[model samples]
Target: MGDPTPTNPQDETSTQPGASPAGWWGKLRDRANQLRSARRLSRWFNVDDDKVAEILAEVRQQLPTTEALLVGKPQAGKSSIVRGLTGVSADIVGQGFRPHTQHTQRYAYPSEDLPLLIFTDTVGLGDLAQATDAIITELVDDLSSSSSKGRILILTVKINDFATDSLRQIAVRLRQQFPTVPCLLAVTCSHEVYPPSQAN
Candidate 1:
């Protein structure tokens, strides 16, 4: 070998006289430094308090101050519907619901500063001997207290169990209680029920 091929200085394995070669520990240290630098840069870019506040204020102003009461039986997909509408995770939904009464709970989206939509979830009716009466009473009282004109009632009914007497009675009672409030019937678990054509 004419001149012992010259080693590239930029090579990580290159070692000078009396200097140790950069091993796995050196590579790990370099990656750690890169991560630290990246974190610092991220923090620098993400720390605009005034801008964040302005954006939040604008969003709050644009959001509609509407409330929707979700009434359904147990496991009627009330929380699932709320999560779908609000794009919040199941964990957040579970944590956000504030118990209003023994049979009712309320969840406000963006549970922090300003909430856009307020959802009131009622406990399952017709489960116990007096559950139906208790739920209706609680709901009626809550609705009577709310002066917000934008309030609406959402009824979640399982598609397969739509013809149940209990569900029909609950619907009739709620309609009577809040005649003016628009009632939206959300049929849940449609996949389990066959199509009309399939019914003999």
Candidate 2:
């Protein structure tokens, strides 16, 4: 006897990996329709939807402001880390970063108009060309002022350029100046570093 014909050929294709119940083009069309419906609904409701607007306003009002200070040397991926955490574009972060002091800059999430979180970035430390002491002093002052407002210090160090003495000094100084604020040490470019056993 000849093999039985499949009752649902479409179902067979849909069962494959990366295949969707709706075909590729079909999914795009569905998404377009959904967007159109959302636009229509938005036009109907406008900002006059008191319930939604009130809820959003209340949520924003209740959100507490927090600060994160990113301390690291050049090319330590500090901005990259900030982008990952806040889901903000690189260009936005680049443009939004405003000088807070000679050696520090600040970027407010959601912009300064409506900020729920603040990220502070310091000038690269341990570089021969820059005045490390002055930069450290600026950083200390910055942290001391903001420590009362729930601040977290993130220390990013490149795996390839791990300068123990400089990092140790920074940590010790921060501990003495801002004991209440918590510090996090992050090792960037870990993938590029060879494992101990793999090293010759």
* Top TM-score model: 2
Model 1 Cα lDDT, one tens digit per residue, 1-200: 58898767766445543245556567778889999999999988785889989998887777677888988887888988999999999999999999878988889887747887899888657576556777778878877884543788888888877545666676798788779889998988876677677853
- Which stretches of model 1 miss by more than 4 angstroms? 1-63, 194-200
lDDT of each: 0.79, 0.80
Candidate 2 lDDT over 1-200, as tens digits, reads 99998679788777874487456767788889999999999998676668777887676666687888888886788988988989999998889899888778899998675578889888757777767677778778776663335688898888888465776777788878888889998988776677777843
User: Which lDDT value does model 1 have at 85?
Assistant: 90
TM-score of each: 0.61, 0.62
lDDT of 1 at 19: 45
Model 2 misplacement above 4 A:
1-63, 146-148, 194-200
lDDT comparing candidate 2 with the true structure: 0.80
Q: Candidate 2: which pairs clash?
A: none
lDDT of 1 at 53: 93
